[model samples]
Target: MISKSTIDKVFESARLEEVIGDFVQLKKSGSNFKGLSPFTDERTPSFMVSPVKQIWKDFSSGKGGNVVAFLMEHEHFTYPEAIRYLAKKYNIEIEETEQNEEQKQQANDRESMYLVSDFAQKYFEDILWNSEKGKAIGLSYFKERGFTDDTIRKFGLGYSLDEWEAFTKEALDKGYSLDFLGRTGLSIIKENKQFDRFKGRVMFPIQSMSGRVLGFGGRILVNDKKAAKYLNSPESDIYHKSKVLYGIYHAKQSIAKEDNCYLVEGYTDVIQFHQRGIENVVASSGTALTPEQIRLINRLTKNITVLFDGDAAGLRASLRGIDLILEQGMNVKVCTFPEGEDPDSFAKKNAYEDLVLYLQENAKDFIQFKASLLVEEAQNDPIKKAETIRDIVQSISKIPDRIQREVYVQECSRIMDISEEVLFNTLAQLGKKNVAEANKKFKKERKAFEVVKKEQAVEKIDVQYQLERKIIEILLLYGNRTEEFEDLLLKENEEGELVLEPELHKARVFEKLYLDLQQDEIELSNENFRTVYYGLISKLNEDDSFVIESYINGLDSELSKEVTSILMEEEKYDLSDWEGKDIYVKDKAESVAQLVGETILNLRCFLIDKRVSDLRQRTLEKKDGNNHEILEEIMNYHQLKKLLSTKLNRVL
Candidate 1:
């Protein structure tokens, strides 16, 4: 466990803008930095980082939190892991508190797996460099593949010993648990005997985008016909092959800066491309491309040029991935090497300038690539040609952007000598079929909701939710500021009629909000928001000098996230350039009292409306008799509603 002092130092040292700017391209927007959301595919900037607040908000995805919270969300880090990452980034030494056995065992399972993977990675590298057999065989193989020592170290390439129990014994001697080793697939247990899983293979450490080791991919060096040439770590808690791309940790910055990614087939291809000055490249690592992999690339760039081996089978295999990329709203281009070459060989064979020039000259957009590849197989056969045309249309239909789809459809028409009308008709049929299927699914889902509604009355949650959230936001932002409040009380006048009379009082914002809600017997309907509200109230009552940062750090991650989101929601987009144009806007602090009172009134009005709705339902259901009291109550509620609306400057 990291001591509290170290966590505080990390929080103080790690600047929000500096940390987030590493992953996102941010521009100055008033007092905050704004950028497109890394969590979502967005054209406009909705992600804002506030250095003053030490938090960030992604309006597009509704994720907001502190720097630690961002790492937890973005990198899937546990709290300690996030803290450690920040501590490392800021060059703060971690101070650890001694843990009891129970505390030690309480470590997150996924974090334990990560620790084991990290240890195994370093262990393999040590062996590859220091062990005699590893140096002679594993290191030699990487060299033979033309990987320079610098490239080898850059990629964290390593080697496992040919002896089965070498790594297992070392790990056990280092006080690491066999369970974790087994869980990470570093050590296999057969009949209760442990041995290394990657024995006799050169190792490639697969990393997450943030450069944490998730697992390993090892290649067997010997020329054994029966043995599999390559073996990968099994899917454990940390590694999902469909979601991880080889060399992404090294390639991401280049991919983002260049605004393009070169997709290749294997690890060597990625390495070779990087060696040849094409740093924006990653490999599917010999697996078929998946939608998850495409979405991963889509985060960095919208354009992907898939480099294929010139073999016919390789081209056929890559055809399906183009449509998948289009479906994700990304641009796909195809580049093929000479007939006898693959990316690894071709990259090694050509100089950097020639390779780049060849790619620039030969890269074809998806429609042209698809048509050219299929035309040879469809020659002299009308049926095959018709099928090929439909295939092209199907790929075009997968594109979500209308302009791109239209351009691709036109290209397909021109290249295949087919009429635009026929291709458009085919696309229309496909779209209609998709919509019909969607409608059937919607109806099925609606039936389930109808049954649920019949079982219990469904509240109008949307408006109430918005009003409740508005109140929470008010409290979170300016809850401690003092303000003048008017207290209303009912009094009988000389005319024998009751009227509301006001008296002035001064109170802190938190005090006023608490009393108003208590008088109305109201609680937030959302459980998470309610918990945070109570926590805020407790802090306001207890502390004389309450700091928002301290309060946020004290809460659990989930509640802290909710509080940050509420505080940051209004900063979703950059404010219009009113100041630049010599226009003035009022600061929120100037009208804090009014904002708080209005939010409280809106919440009360929403509750009263729900009460009136319930009363009307009862009046209707009991129409036979004895419903006069309910109707009278409804009339009184309407009068109350009118007064509330009057306070809000609305005519009812």
Candidate 2:
């Protein structure tokens, strides 16, 4: 288990914006940072991070908490794993006790798989550097490819031994489970026999954006016609190839910093670029481009420059990915190396400056590149020319922004020398067809239960729930603040009527809220709110100086989530720039006393209204002829409600 001191150190050192910015491209908004929701597919930014509060909220998905929560949610990390990730990111040393055998065995299946994959990576790396066969084969291959020792180790490149059972046998001897080893595809087991999957191959670890080893891609060294040259780990609980991009772990920051990503096809292509000082490059790992992979790049930048080999067939085959990039509302540019050269070879041959210069000079807008390449094939053929124009129009239709689509349409017209009217007409037909097909698919896939659910009436507002939530929000934001409040005293007036007399008193907000709720014998209706409410009050009572970050970190996930939602509810409006537009936003801090008193009064009014409702129901039932008592009770509650409503400025 990680020590409390270490966790605290992590919370203190790990900045929420900096950590989340590594995954999502965050732009400054007022006092906070805002970005597209990583949890949801959004065109506009709804994910917000508050550096002042050290908490983040995704208004789109309603997921919010401190830095740890963001990691847990975005990376699917367990709590301990999240803490460790933050610790590593901030360069804080973790103080953790060694896990016992039982504890290690108790880890979940996915975590165990992760452990096995990580172990495999380390084991492979050790072999590459230390083992005789590894140094002779794996080290030699990497050196021959023009990779320095630092570059090889930076990518965690390693080698698996030539013998079939070498990795499998060593892993078992070291207490790593065969189940996980086989599951990670590090070892293949069949018919009660086990052998290494990447025998006689060098290893290239495929890592997640956070640098966790998800799997590996191994390339064989020797010319064995019977064996495939390159192989990847099979799909497992941890690794999904389509969703994984090679070198994302190293390239994410550079991609975000440069505001562009370089796309290539193979692992070597990504490594060579990074080796050449072009860090914002990732590869598809030889898989066809996927929406999930595109979205990964989309998180860092809106621009993608796809690097292609000069082979005409390969370039043509990769054209489909440009359409995919456009579909994700990203700007795409394509660059191709000279014939007989790919990204790996070209980068190897060029100096860093030349490589950078070549990419800058050769990169062409996807439309221009697509047109030029297709025009050659369509030369002197009218039918093929029309088809090519239609194809370009279809690609243009994939762009989500209307203005961008229009701009691209004009560009395509100029490139192909086609009439703007003809291209626009074709685009309209394609749009209609797409919409019709989408509707048909939606109707066909629509479940009976979903239709029934949609037909259900909207739920009415829960007054008690709203009031309870409001009280919690007030407590979280201003509980530690000491404010002078207008205390309402119930007394007999000149007319012998129950009257609320206002008296000024100074007390901490939590003290005032606590006394009010305690006097009324009220409890929050929502269980989550009740837990957070009591915990928050207890913390405030214990310490005069309340730190929301530490308090939130101490709570369990559910309560932490609730507290974050409450704390960040007001932050949502920060993105609106109301003050910049000459509309002033009310500072809640200035009205802490009134806000606290009003929330308490609202809760009291809601509860009293509920009691009155119950009393009225009892009178209607006429239970045991207690109508007289019920009427008197109802009248008293009504009077109380009236007094509270007066203070709240609400009609009874």
Q: Against the unseen true structure, what C-alpha lDDT does each candidate score?
A: 0.86, 0.90
* Candidate number of the best lDDT: 2
Per-residue lDDT tens digits for candidate 2, residues 1-652, read 8998998898888888889988999999888998888888877888889998889999999999988889888888998999999888878998988888998767899898898898899999999999999999999999999999899989999999999898899889999899899889999999879999999899999999999999999999988899999999999999999999999999999999999999988899988889889999999999899999999998999999998888857677789999999999999999988998999999999999999899899999999999999999999999999988988998999999999999999999898888899889999999999999998988887797598888999989998888888888887788888899999999998999999999998999889988999998887778898888899899999998898888888888888898888888888997787887999978988888878888888788878888899888877888577587788888899888888898888875
What are the per-model numbers of colliding residue pairs? 0, 0
Q: Which consecutive 10 residues in model 2 have the weakest lDDT in total?
A: 617-626
lDDT, candidate 1, 1-652, per-residue tens: 7999999899779888877765676778899888778788665677898877888999889998888888888888988888998898889999999889998888888888888888899999998888898789988999999989999999999999989899999999998888899989999988868899999999999998888999999999889898789899999889999989999989988987888999998899999999989999999888889987887787677899999998847677678889889888889899988898999999988999999999999999988888988888999899999999999999998999998888888889899998899989999999999999999998989989888878896555598778778877777777888899877665677997556577888999989999999998998898987888898888888886877877777778788888898778767635445677888778888888788878887887888899999998887788587988898998877877777777789988
Estimate the overall C-alpha local distance difference test score of candidate 1. 0.86
Winning model by TM-score: 2
Cα displacement (angstroms), candidate 1, residue 579, comes to: 14
TM-score of 1: 0.82
Estimate TM-scores for all models.
0.82, 0.97
lDDT of 2 at 629: 74
